[model samples]
Target: MKKLLITGLLALCLLTQNLLSQTAWAEDANDSVPLKTVTLSEWEAVLKSHQGEIVVVDFWATWCISCLERFPHMVTMSERYQSKKVRFISMLLEDPEEPEAIALAHQFLNKQFLNKQLKGKNGLAFDHYSMNENLMKSFEVLDLLGIPAVFIYNKGQLTHRLTGDNPNKQFTDKDIEEAILALLKSS
Candidate 1:
Protein backbone atom coordinates (compact mmCIF):
# COMPACT_ATOMS: atom_id res chain seq x y z
CA MET A 1 0.00 0.00 0.00
CA LYS A 2 2.83 2.41 0.86
CA LYS A 3 4.65 1.68 -2.41
CA LEU A 4 1.45 2.19 -4.45
CA LEU A 5 0.73 5.57 -2.79
CA ILE A 6 4.29 6.75 -3.49
CA THR A 7 3.99 5.76 -7.19
CA GLY A 8 0.69 7.69 -7.52
CA LEU A 9 2.24 10.84 -6.02
CA LEU A 10 5.25 10.51 -8.31
CA ALA A 11 3.00 10.22 -11.39
CA LEU A 12 0.98 13.30 -10.34
CA CYS A 13 4.17 15.34 -9.93
CA LEU A 14 5.45 14.34 -13.35
CA LEU A 15 2.07 15.15 -14.96
CA THR A 16 1.96 18.60 -13.33
CA GLN A 17 5.51 19.34 -14.47
CA ASN A 18 4.68 18.28 -18.03
CA LEU A 19 1.59 20.49 -18.19
CA LEU A 20 3.49 23.57 -16.89
CA SER A 21 6.36 22.96 -19.34
CA GLN A 22 3.92 22.75 -22.28
CA THR A 23 2.23 26.02 -21.27
CA ALA A 24 5.58 27.80 -20.96
CA TRP A 25 6.67 26.57 -24.38
CA ALA A 26 3.40 27.75 -25.97
CA GLU A 27 3.74 31.22 -24.36
CA ASP A 28 7.31 31.56 -25.64
CA ALA A 29 6.24 30.66 -29.18
CA ASN A 30 3.26 33.03 -29.16
CA ASP A 31 5.39 35.94 -27.89
CA SER A 32 7.01 36.21 -31.34
CA VAL A 33 3.72 37.21 -33.03
CA PRO A 34 3.98 41.02 -33.24
CA LEU A 35 0.85 42.98 -32.29
CA LYS A 36 2.43 46.38 -31.80
CA THR A 37 1.21 49.53 -33.56
CA VAL A 38 2.00 49.00 -37.26
CA THR A 39 3.90 51.75 -39.12
CA LEU A 40 3.02 52.89 -42.66
CA SER A 41 5.97 50.94 -43.97
CA GLU A 42 4.69 47.87 -42.19
CA TRP A 43 1.15 48.45 -43.48
CA GLU A 44 2.47 48.93 -46.98
CA ALA A 45 4.57 45.81 -46.62
CA VAL A 46 1.51 43.83 -45.58
CA LEU A 47 -0.46 45.29 -48.46
CA LYS A 48 2.20 44.79 -51.12
CA SER A 49 3.47 41.53 -49.60
CA HIS A 50 0.43 39.35 -50.20
CA GLN A 51 0.80 37.49 -53.46
CA GLY A 52 -2.72 36.34 -54.25
CA GLU A 53 -4.70 38.10 -51.55
CA ILE A 54 -6.99 41.10 -51.76
CA VAL A 55 -6.23 43.84 -49.23
CA VAL A 56 -8.95 46.38 -48.46
CA VAL A 57 -7.39 49.37 -46.75
CA ASP A 58 -9.85 51.79 -45.22
CA PHE A 59 -8.58 55.23 -44.23
CA TRP A 60 -11.01 56.39 -41.59
CA ALA A 61 -11.33 58.32 -38.32
CA THR A 62 -13.28 57.87 -35.12
CA TRP A 63 -14.81 61.34 -35.49
CA CYS A 64 -16.16 60.72 -38.98
CA ILE A 65 -19.83 59.72 -38.63
CA SER A 66 -19.72 58.45 -42.18
CA CYS A 67 -16.72 56.31 -41.39
CA LEU A 68 -18.14 54.87 -38.19
CA GLU A 69 -21.50 54.22 -39.83
CA ARG A 70 -19.89 52.02 -42.46
CA PHE A 71 -18.10 49.85 -39.85
CA PRO A 72 -20.90 47.33 -39.50
CA HIS A 73 -20.66 46.72 -43.23
CA MET A 74 -16.91 46.36 -42.88
CA VAL A 75 -17.18 43.82 -40.07
CA THR A 76 -19.88 41.92 -41.90
CA MET A 77 -17.79 41.83 -45.08
CA SER A 78 -14.77 40.67 -43.12
CA GLU A 79 -16.64 37.75 -41.58
CA ARG A 80 -18.48 36.85 -44.76
CA TYR A 81 -15.37 36.69 -46.90
CA GLN A 82 -12.57 35.84 -44.46
CA SER A 83 -11.88 32.48 -46.09
CA LYS A 84 -11.04 33.93 -49.53
CA LYS A 85 -7.78 35.80 -48.77
CA VAL A 86 -9.65 39.03 -48.05
CA ARG A 87 -7.78 41.28 -45.65
CA PHE A 88 -9.62 44.23 -44.13
CA ILE A 89 -7.64 46.84 -42.26
CA SER A 90 -9.15 50.05 -40.95
CA MET A 91 -6.51 52.61 -39.98
CA LEU A 92 -6.92 55.91 -38.12
CA LEU A 93 -4.93 58.99 -39.10
CA GLU A 94 -4.41 60.61 -35.68
CA ASP A 95 -1.54 63.05 -36.06
CA PRO A 96 0.14 65.08 -33.31
CA GLU A 97 0.56 67.55 -36.16
CA GLU A 98 -3.20 67.57 -36.58
CA PRO A 99 -4.37 68.16 -33.03
CA GLU A 100 -7.73 69.50 -34.13
CA ALA A 101 -8.69 66.24 -35.84
CA ILE A 102 -7.54 64.23 -32.83
CA ALA A 103 -9.52 66.48 -30.46
CA LEU A 104 -12.59 66.15 -32.66
CA ALA A 105 -12.10 62.39 -32.74
CA HIS A 106 -11.90 62.31 -28.94
CA GLN A 107 -15.02 64.42 -28.50
CA PHE A 108 -16.98 62.45 -31.07
CA LEU A 109 -16.06 59.10 -29.57
CA ASN A 110 -16.43 60.23 -25.94
CA LYS A 111 -19.16 62.83 -25.72
CA GLN A 112 -21.48 61.52 -28.42
CA PHE A 113 -20.80 57.86 -29.15
CA LEU A 114 -24.05 56.31 -27.98
CA ASN A 115 -22.24 55.23 -24.77
CA LYS A 116 -19.11 54.20 -26.69
CA GLN A 117 -20.47 51.55 -29.04
CA LEU A 118 -19.22 53.03 -32.34
CA LYS A 119 -15.72 54.02 -31.09
CA GLY A 120 -14.94 50.38 -30.21
CA LYS A 121 -13.47 49.49 -26.83
CA ASN A 122 -9.80 49.45 -27.91
CA GLY A 123 -10.21 51.86 -30.94
CA LEU A 124 -8.46 51.98 -34.32
CA ALA A 125 -4.75 51.67 -35.20
CA PHE A 126 -3.63 55.33 -35.27
CA ASP A 127 0.16 54.91 -35.58
CA HIS A 128 0.19 54.00 -39.28
CA TYR A 129 2.64 55.96 -41.46
CA SER A 130 -0.08 57.48 -43.66
CA MET A 131 -0.27 60.31 -41.12
CA ASN A 132 3.10 61.43 -42.57
CA GLU A 133 3.04 63.52 -45.76
CA ASN A 134 5.47 61.23 -47.50
CA LEU A 135 3.45 58.14 -46.58
CA MET A 136 0.30 59.87 -47.77
CA LYS A 137 2.01 60.40 -51.10
CA SER A 138 3.06 56.76 -51.10
CA PHE A 139 -0.62 55.89 -50.59
CA GLU A 140 -1.42 57.98 -53.69
CA VAL A 141 -3.72 60.39 -51.87
CA LEU A 142 -2.28 63.57 -53.37
CA ASP A 143 -4.79 65.55 -55.48
CA LEU A 144 -7.98 63.47 -55.15
CA LEU A 145 -8.20 62.57 -51.46
CA GLY A 146 -11.25 62.08 -49.29
CA ILE A 147 -12.15 60.77 -45.91
CA PRO A 148 -13.16 57.06 -45.50
CA ALA A 149 -11.10 56.38 -48.54
CA VAL A 150 -11.26 52.66 -49.30
CA PHE A 151 -8.52 51.22 -51.48
CA ILE A 152 -8.79 47.73 -52.88
CA TYR A 153 -5.37 46.44 -53.75
CA ASN A 154 -5.33 43.11 -55.56
CA LYS A 155 -2.10 41.17 -55.90
CA GLY A 156 -0.09 44.28 -54.81
CA GLN A 157 -1.64 46.52 -57.46
CA LEU A 158 -4.21 49.26 -56.99
CA THR A 159 -7.46 47.95 -58.43
CA HIS A 160 -10.31 50.13 -57.14
CA ARG A 161 -10.37 53.40 -55.22
CA LEU A 162 -13.67 54.33 -53.53
CA THR A 163 -13.55 57.83 -52.14
CA GLY A 164 -15.80 60.17 -50.20
CA ASP A 165 -18.98 59.20 -48.29
CA ASN A 166 -19.63 56.28 -50.65
CA PRO A 167 -18.46 58.38 -53.63
CA ASN A 168 -21.98 59.10 -54.86
CA LYS A 169 -22.97 60.62 -51.48
CA GLN A 170 -25.27 57.60 -51.13
CA PHE A 171 -23.59 55.23 -48.67
CA THR A 172 -25.31 51.92 -48.29
CA ASP A 173 -24.53 48.49 -46.87
CA LYS A 174 -24.89 46.91 -50.31
CA ASP A 175 -22.24 49.21 -51.76
CA ILE A 176 -19.67 48.10 -49.16
CA GLU A 177 -20.55 44.45 -49.67
CA GLU A 178 -20.26 44.78 -53.42
CA ALA A 179 -16.94 46.63 -53.18
CA ILE A 180 -15.44 43.98 -50.92
CA LEU A 181 -16.64 41.20 -53.19
CA ALA A 182 -15.27 43.00 -56.24
CA LEU A 183 -11.83 43.21 -54.63
CA LEU A 184 -11.90 39.59 -53.51
CA LYS A 185 -12.94 38.42 -56.98
CA SER A 186 -9.88 40.05 -58.54
CA SER A 187 -7.62 38.03 -56.22
Candidate 2:
Protein backbone atom coordinates (compact mmCIF):
# COMPACT_ATOMS: atom_id res chain seq x y z
CA MET A 1 0.00 0.00 0.00
CA LYS A 2 2.87 2.39 0.76
CA LYS A 3 4.50 1.68 -2.58
CA LEU A 4 1.22 2.29 -4.38
CA LEU A 5 0.77 5.66 -2.63
CA ILE A 6 4.28 6.71 -3.53
CA THR A 7 3.80 5.89 -7.20
CA GLY A 8 0.49 7.75 -7.37
CA LEU A 9 2.03 10.80 -5.67
CA LEU A 10 4.91 10.76 -8.10
CA ALA A 11 2.53 10.56 -11.03
CA LEU A 12 0.52 13.50 -9.73
CA CYS A 13 3.62 15.62 -9.31
CA LEU A 14 4.83 14.81 -12.83
CA LEU A 15 1.43 15.65 -14.29
CA THR A 16 1.32 18.94 -12.43
CA GLN A 17 4.80 19.82 -13.62
CA ASN A 18 3.90 19.02 -17.21
CA LEU A 19 0.80 21.19 -17.11
CA LEU A 20 2.78 24.08 -15.63
CA SER A 21 5.41 23.79 -18.31
CA GLN A 22 2.77 23.85 -21.01
CA THR A 23 1.24 26.98 -19.56
CA ALA A 24 4.60 28.69 -19.43
CA TRP A 25 5.32 27.67 -23.01
CA ALA A 26 2.04 29.18 -24.12
CA GLU A 27 2.80 32.47 -22.37
CA ASP A 28 6.27 32.54 -23.82
CA ALA A 29 4.99 31.85 -27.30
CA ASN A 30 2.43 34.64 -27.03
CA ASP A 31 5.09 37.14 -25.94
CA SER A 32 7.68 36.20 -28.52
CA VAL A 33 5.81 37.30 -31.65
CA PRO A 34 4.44 40.58 -33.04
CA LEU A 35 1.17 40.80 -35.01
CA LYS A 36 -0.08 43.55 -37.30
CA THR A 37 -3.54 45.07 -37.43
CA VAL A 38 -5.53 45.58 -40.63
CA THR A 39 -8.64 47.55 -41.47
CA LEU A 40 -11.79 46.11 -43.07
CA SER A 41 -11.04 47.57 -46.47
CA GLU A 42 -7.56 46.12 -46.41
CA TRP A 43 -8.97 42.75 -45.46
CA GLU A 44 -11.39 42.93 -48.37
CA ALA A 45 -8.56 43.85 -50.66
CA VAL A 46 -6.85 40.67 -49.56
CA LEU A 47 -9.90 38.62 -50.47
CA LYS A 48 -10.22 40.47 -53.74
CA SER A 49 -6.61 39.74 -54.55
CA HIS A 50 -7.35 36.05 -54.09
CA GLN A 51 -10.32 36.18 -56.42
CA GLY A 52 -10.72 33.38 -58.99
CA GLU A 53 -9.83 30.79 -56.36
CA ILE A 54 -11.40 29.02 -53.40
CA VAL A 55 -10.72 30.86 -50.14
CA VAL A 56 -11.60 29.52 -46.72
CA VAL A 57 -12.04 32.33 -44.21
CA ASP A 58 -12.01 31.13 -40.62
CA PHE A 59 -13.27 33.62 -38.03
CA TRP A 60 -11.94 32.82 -34.58
CA ALA A 61 -10.69 34.40 -31.32
CA THR A 62 -8.14 33.63 -28.63
CA TRP A 63 -10.67 33.49 -25.80
CA CYS A 64 -13.17 31.26 -27.58
CA ILE A 65 -13.03 27.69 -26.30
CA SER A 66 -15.18 26.42 -29.13
CA CYS A 67 -12.88 27.99 -31.67
CA LEU A 68 -9.91 26.26 -30.10
CA GLU A 69 -11.77 22.97 -30.13
CA ARG A 70 -12.60 23.30 -33.81
CA PHE A 71 -9.23 24.70 -34.85
CA PRO A 72 -7.30 21.47 -35.39
CA HIS A 73 -9.90 20.12 -37.80
CA MET A 74 -9.68 23.30 -39.82
CA VAL A 75 -5.91 22.98 -39.86
CA THR A 76 -6.24 19.45 -41.12
CA MET A 77 -8.67 20.58 -43.79
CA SER A 78 -6.24 23.28 -44.84
CA GLU A 79 -3.51 20.70 -45.18
CA ARG A 80 -5.74 18.34 -47.14
CA TYR A 81 -6.88 20.97 -49.66
CA GLN A 82 -3.48 22.62 -49.93
CA SER A 83 -2.59 20.93 -53.19
CA LYS A 84 -5.85 22.04 -54.81
CA LYS A 85 -6.68 25.59 -55.80
CA VAL A 86 -7.84 26.38 -52.29
CA ARG A 87 -6.48 29.09 -49.99
CA PHE A 88 -6.99 28.98 -46.25
CA ILE A 89 -6.99 32.13 -44.13
CA SER A 90 -7.53 32.42 -40.37
CA MET A 91 -9.24 35.71 -39.39
CA LEU A 92 -9.19 36.55 -35.73
CA LEU A 93 -12.43 38.24 -34.61
CA GLU A 94 -11.10 39.94 -31.54
CA ASP A 95 -12.44 43.03 -29.81
CA PRO A 96 -12.09 45.78 -32.40
CA GLU A 97 -11.91 48.38 -29.61
CA GLU A 98 -9.18 46.77 -27.52
CA PRO A 99 -5.58 47.03 -28.64
CA GLU A 100 -4.42 44.52 -26.05
CA ALA A 101 -6.98 42.02 -27.28
CA ILE A 102 -5.69 42.49 -30.80
CA ALA A 103 -2.16 41.86 -29.61
CA LEU A 104 -3.26 38.72 -27.78
CA ALA A 105 -4.96 37.53 -30.92
CA HIS A 106 -1.71 37.80 -32.83
CA GLN A 107 0.09 35.94 -30.09
CA PHE A 108 -2.50 33.19 -30.31
CA LEU A 109 -1.80 32.97 -34.02
CA ASN A 110 1.89 32.63 -33.29
CA LYS A 111 1.23 29.82 -30.84
CA GLN A 112 -0.94 28.04 -33.37
CA PHE A 113 1.53 28.47 -36.20
CA LEU A 114 4.24 27.01 -34.03
CA ASN A 115 2.11 24.30 -32.48
CA LYS A 116 3.57 20.85 -32.79
CA GLN A 117 0.19 19.19 -33.25
CA LEU A 118 -0.91 21.48 -36.08
CA LYS A 119 2.31 22.24 -37.94
CA GLY A 120 5.05 19.88 -36.83
CA LYS A 121 3.34 16.70 -38.00
CA ASN A 122 2.12 17.99 -41.37
CA GLY A 123 4.26 21.10 -41.76
CA LEU A 124 1.15 22.98 -42.91
CA ALA A 125 -0.21 26.36 -41.88
CA PHE A 126 -2.09 29.28 -43.38
CA ASP A 127 -1.72 33.04 -43.46
CA HIS A 128 -3.05 34.70 -40.31
CA TYR A 129 -5.36 37.76 -40.23
CA SER A 130 -7.28 39.92 -37.77
CA MET A 131 -10.59 41.59 -38.64
CA ASN A 132 -11.94 45.02 -37.72
CA GLU A 133 -15.53 46.28 -37.47
CA ASN A 134 -15.68 47.28 -41.09
CA LEU A 135 -14.47 43.90 -42.17
CA MET A 136 -16.94 42.10 -39.90
CA LYS A 137 -19.81 44.27 -41.12
CA SER A 138 -18.76 43.65 -44.69
CA PHE A 139 -18.81 39.93 -43.98
CA GLU A 140 -22.25 40.22 -42.29
CA VAL A 141 -20.86 39.02 -38.98
CA LEU A 142 -23.81 40.46 -37.06
CA ASP A 143 -26.07 37.81 -38.50
CA LEU A 144 -24.36 35.20 -36.39
CA LEU A 145 -24.42 34.93 -32.62
CA GLY A 146 -21.04 33.23 -32.06
CA ILE A 147 -17.99 31.86 -33.70
CA PRO A 148 -15.87 30.08 -34.93
CA ALA A 149 -17.51 30.89 -38.26
CA VAL A 150 -16.13 29.71 -41.55
CA PHE A 151 -16.84 31.30 -44.92
CA ILE A 152 -15.99 29.74 -48.22
CA TYR A 153 -15.37 32.18 -51.03
CA ASN A 154 -15.10 31.44 -54.71
CA LYS A 155 -13.81 33.96 -57.19
CA GLY A 156 -14.39 36.80 -54.72
CA GLN A 157 -17.98 35.74 -53.96
CA LEU A 158 -19.21 34.44 -50.64
CA THR A 159 -20.44 30.91 -51.28
CA HIS A 160 -20.78 29.10 -47.96
CA ARG A 161 -20.93 30.02 -44.29
CA LEU A 162 -20.27 27.41 -41.56
CA THR A 163 -20.78 28.24 -37.94
CA GLY A 164 -19.61 26.45 -34.80
CA ASP A 165 -21.54 25.86 -31.52
CA ASN A 166 -24.96 27.06 -32.59
CA PRO A 167 -27.44 25.44 -30.18
CA ASN A 168 -25.01 22.53 -29.82
CA LYS A 169 -24.36 22.35 -33.56
CA GLN A 170 -20.75 22.18 -34.70
CA PHE A 171 -19.40 21.57 -38.18
CA THR A 172 -17.44 18.42 -38.89
CA ASP A 173 -14.41 17.92 -41.10
CA LYS A 174 -16.50 16.12 -43.72
CA ASP A 175 -18.92 19.05 -43.90
CA ILE A 176 -16.14 21.59 -44.59
CA GLU A 177 -14.37 19.28 -47.04
CA GLU A 178 -17.57 18.71 -48.99
CA ALA A 179 -18.04 22.45 -49.40
CA ILE A 180 -14.50 22.87 -50.64
CA LEU A 181 -14.87 19.95 -53.05
CA ALA A 182 -18.12 21.35 -54.42
CA LEU A 183 -16.50 24.73 -54.95
CA LEU A 184 -13.53 23.19 -56.68
CA LYS A 185 -15.82 21.27 -59.00
CA SER A 186 -17.78 24.42 -59.80
CA SER A 187 -14.67 26.41 -60.65
- Best-matching candidate per TM-score: 2
C-alpha RMSD between model 2 and the true structure: 10.2
Q: Which parts of model 1 are misplaced by more than 4 Å?
A: 1-39, 97-144, 165-171, 183-187
Cα lDDT, model 1, residue 107: 44
Worst 10 residues of 1 by lDDT: 121-130
Query: How would you encode candidate 2's per-residue C-alpha lDDT over 21-105 as one tens digit per residue?
Result: 9999897755453344567778778889889778998878877888877777776787777788588888777768787877767
Per-residue lDDT of 19 in model 1: 100
Q: Count steric clashes of candidate 1.
A: 1
- What total of clashing residue pairs does each candidate reach? 1, 0
RMSD (Cα, Å) of model 1: 11.6
lDDT tens digits, residues 118-163, model 1? 2332332211223444435534643335566677667778776677
TM-scores of all predicted structures: 0.53, 0.66
